[model samples]
Target: MYHIPNKYYYRLHQIRPRFKNDVENVLIYMATCLSNLSEMPSDKFAKAMNNAIKLFPGNANKKDKTINNWRTEISALFGLIETDSINQTSKPSNLAFKLSENQDLVEFFKYFLFYFQYPGGYLKPHEILDYINQGILFKPVSYLINVLQEGEKITEGRFYIDKAETTHCIFNDLRVTRQNNPRKPKNTAYLVIHNRKNNINYNWTGDVIRYAGDILDYMVIADLLVCHGNKFYLNNKNQEVIVSFIENEVIFLDYIPLYKKLNLNINDVKSLNDAWFYFVNSKLDQEIFKTDLYKYLGVDSTTYQDLVLDSINEFESKLEQGVEIKTKEIGDFGEGLVLGHEKMRIKRGKREDLLHLIQKIPTQFAVGYDIQSVEFDERKRYIEVKTTISNKKINFFSFHLTPNEWNTAESLKDRYYVYRLAISKINRELHLIQDPVGLYKSNKITMSPKDGADITFTEESSQKEKLLLWID
Candidate 1:
């Protein structure tokens, strides 16, 4: 249940790192400190980090209280630093050395935000246990992105999230319900954050804005969100990148497991390291692409139902006029076409129960195939859907393929398909090329050389072609 605090304020109970442009500098500095220490206890490492910050340019007189803890855990969480109880030593991780060389400011934080989660290594186990329960497991940055993506308006080409709504859901107490799809529990763990009707008080301390807003600020610095006035929107130019990232179901180990492991034998240093490593690396497993947005958002809003209508209408209107949309948008439209057809095919076959088996792998996964389905005979099919809006004649119509997709087609020869939709203001046609790699092997479709190359198919001459009238 969501508690309307004394003033509707919500705070993160964990200590957050200094989220700024120069935050990378602190990490770089910590990497330097870790260089000399092969191994050390947590307390000594903490003290060393406290003194090391003073040597940093701007942190000369910075308070020494929590800086050390932040340095250790933040670095540890992002794989920048490592702890090993086996040798009683700490070392900078390989990523730390790479970050020092690349000096990618935005990439640094993006990597961190992708993995950062609540009940992380920042606080002592007791502190984390005080507030964190099975009820409160989340990846704040991912959750923030998920919520922001919630308020996206595709028709307007705008993506903005409700500041108050997102803050309350993440920082304030809410009824979180976990429902594992029994058939695919590990594959799909559903976490629903429900909106309760009554106002209750949650004593989470710290400035609500400071706790929540700082996270949003970090996302902005990482080129994920752009702030306008009081609103937050997904960075338009970075939308493709954002789409790729928001699907990451980073894991966070639950508190109970850690306590159980820690309680067994604190003296077993290597086991302790094993447990600590698991704790830091784990995150909430909520895949954005497969999940229904409203399930997590709580309210029975039609936002979920409206996304498809808005996006498809906008895309169709643009396509019907031969106006170009982004490459990513066109790609999504193609996949949606195939997905709709798959669902319809299953329903018509009187097998609605198996409808959930069809899955669309998001672009970020770079898995080559866009949709995973099955033939009427129950044979699996991996489809790469390509949509093109061009005035090129049917004789000249062709689609580009990534090397990954082509290799996948070559590997899954019989099970692979290319659902290419050529759309123009004058007409629309769908081409289904099964076993495109086999077609190539039989010299049916010519492969043109380009970046990742394009598979050229002239409809009049190919025996492996089918006109998909059912796509409409």
Candidate 2:
């Protein structure tokens, strides 16, 4: 697929020593300009051209026609206008849909060389030879590899290099081959980037992402050629594949988030429950504990994925106790756990399952809905779900309560009610307490970490502890 233009190759070989840096500058400038095309402002593009012109130290002495033509071409490429009239002499004007030739890689590079060495100077033959060292070929090639690697859907994909003798079999234009020997090729090492991204479940821009395993299989063919000291011709079909590899590499280097921290953006999420974990744990960033988890979780603001992960971890730890509840009639006060081992195994679906439960809540008690689920209005009119550690004293901690349940006391007004469940080995007991805020209104009720005071409970005289009666 690679058509090495004789003219381009020849021109590159002819540059003299003095022109080398200038040519390189022009190439760099061209790259900068091309990179800007994706999101460049009209004003900035003009400035970019002006900056390129300033780079020529001896611009004042350059020939009139040559300089004029150079400026016209470059300016046109960036959508700028040239004025021959004396009236608007100094100011540059804007134009639409700049010249198309400037978009070509060869044109850009050629102009770059001219821009850098204008007054004189060019790359010497020996220097040009030195510049295209082995590593240089890999630089651009690596970009292509990176693009393909990034397109891989699996997080744990890998890459490998192989040198082997191989013969490529052509089948429907896709290069196919199998090798008889295990030995790799010489001088050519295949870099295999593998991932499950190309699996049936993943939808990808097909040519862009090659499973690392597939790449290795193709290498088997290439290995044969290298072993036999034969050069293999790459078909045109591989061109896009090559470009995608480079694109993915560049993208990964410049944009993707690092795995060490979850850059949780609360604005991206709709659920209050999802946001609550972030809001609460975001406070931990201020806590000067030895762990210093704020920085660890990548919380530039209060938003973080660590909060979600932490809540899930804590919830899972509690599952070992075999949550249970005693019947309210037996004076054993406890609410039933929504999910127990009897119904389903404790899996890594805490957040998702909880979200589902929230949605399943009767729409009559709902306040809002989004693409994924619904939420109860904060008006104390809705039931709040909470978890109790045991049925012993009916007093316990509620680690990850739904947002609606937590807010009824404040946002729901007096209608907020707490539905408490006592988890145990056998089953759970359910208890409902209405308007728990009344307890705090009279008694100097203080919320502590040991026992969260944020919850709303029933008045002392009310015997309405069985929550099932109110709903079922």
Candidate 3:
């Protein structure tokens, strides 16, 4: 019931000069003490005046005069007139007022002051009415108060319902759009989840669903099954089990069998509702969901499935050919992709000429860098590309860097950038870490020599030799 005076009161004090000090005190007193009361008695007002006098000793002897002055100032400034006779025996008459008469002041109080004091940035209709009544007692026959109360009730109800709906299934369409890049064209992908009844749609870069243990496991399994070309499934009775998709659409699947196929314990899952709740609240899971199988693939389920299979086949074929060939092919592919991205970005600044200057250093010699590009300001960018086909369940990525590469990055300083490419069967995500040596120095990335080498780069050339460093 503690009502904080909002900016409206301060602005009113600035504009209204007459009885400004007295009116301000009266208003503060009303907000602090009488915020929940319909009316305050004359004796109570006298006590408030006495308390004020005690706080400011200069007015201790003139309390009666100050109280009379406050009464007149309140009536003159705020139109809050005393209705009851000044007799101790009779009960005080209700001081009728209406905050709704000043729409701006009401909004200022509700949105600015009341919102800060209320829990969850929301106020119930009854609390709103109480706050309004604190400033002005609405008349018995007022239609405005009723309308405001009813409107607030409807709005609050709708807000809660919408919040509840978002905890279920949500469909997200992420369109990867790049300008001036011809190698990787723009494409759209659909992220569909089989949770509860709710179906929400979003167009953004981050995850739409929250992730928890059970929910993350479930979603990972779903993506794996979808990629493995297992869309339709039957229950123990051999009937098609329908699961919720987007907006009244259903997919055929029995999640129990899917769980069994993934070797996940069915007992860990409480219910689909519980999974949905966790999925709608996890930040890490949301990121995983966004990039898992949706960012670099097709919009439809069939196309997505086909892309997954094709990627798998291509990977298997390359591995069968030779390990060295597979590594070279993947390295070349990643460097080309990154080079194209760099060209697109540079072209935005009208520095397309830099594209020709950018060289693929990995194939040329034993240089630690991969591609070399120029910034808009004509500064050099030493880029090292590391590509991986592992899923995001592995929180950290480990890659090897030659001693020459570490020395180059250390010497280049800010010019060096590590572009980590996390490639899954259906999508690929790139994360850039600038100044790898600086990152290691700042403890952002851990670095250590591989094979337990004790060689130090700062030592003489005789003791220091090229050795690989394992970075995570």
Q: Compare the candidates by TM-score and give the number of the best one.
A: 1
lDDT of 3 by residue, 248-302 (tens): 1111122223323443432322223222222212222111122232232223565
Model 2 stretches astray by more than 4 angstroms: 1-380, 389-407, 444-446, 449-472
Score candidate 1 by lDDT.
Answer: 0.55
Please name the candidate that would achieve the greatest lDDT relative to the true structure: 1
Please identify which of the two predictions, 1 or 3, would achieve the higher TM-score against the true structure. 1
If ranked by TM-score, best first, what sequence of candidates would result?
Answer: 1, 3, 2
What local lDDT score does residue 373 receive in model 2, on the 0 to 100 scale? 22
Comparing 1 with 3 on lDDT, the higher-scoring candidate is 1
How far off is residue 339 in model 2, in Å?
Answer: 11
lDDT of 2 at 282: 22
Worst 10 residues of 1 by lDDT: 179-188
What lDDT score belongs to each candidate, Candidate 1 first?
0.55, 0.28, 0.35
- In the predicted model 1, the residue pairs found to clash are 1-175, 39-89, 251-282, 251-283, 252-282, 252-283
**lDDT rank order:** 1, 3, 2
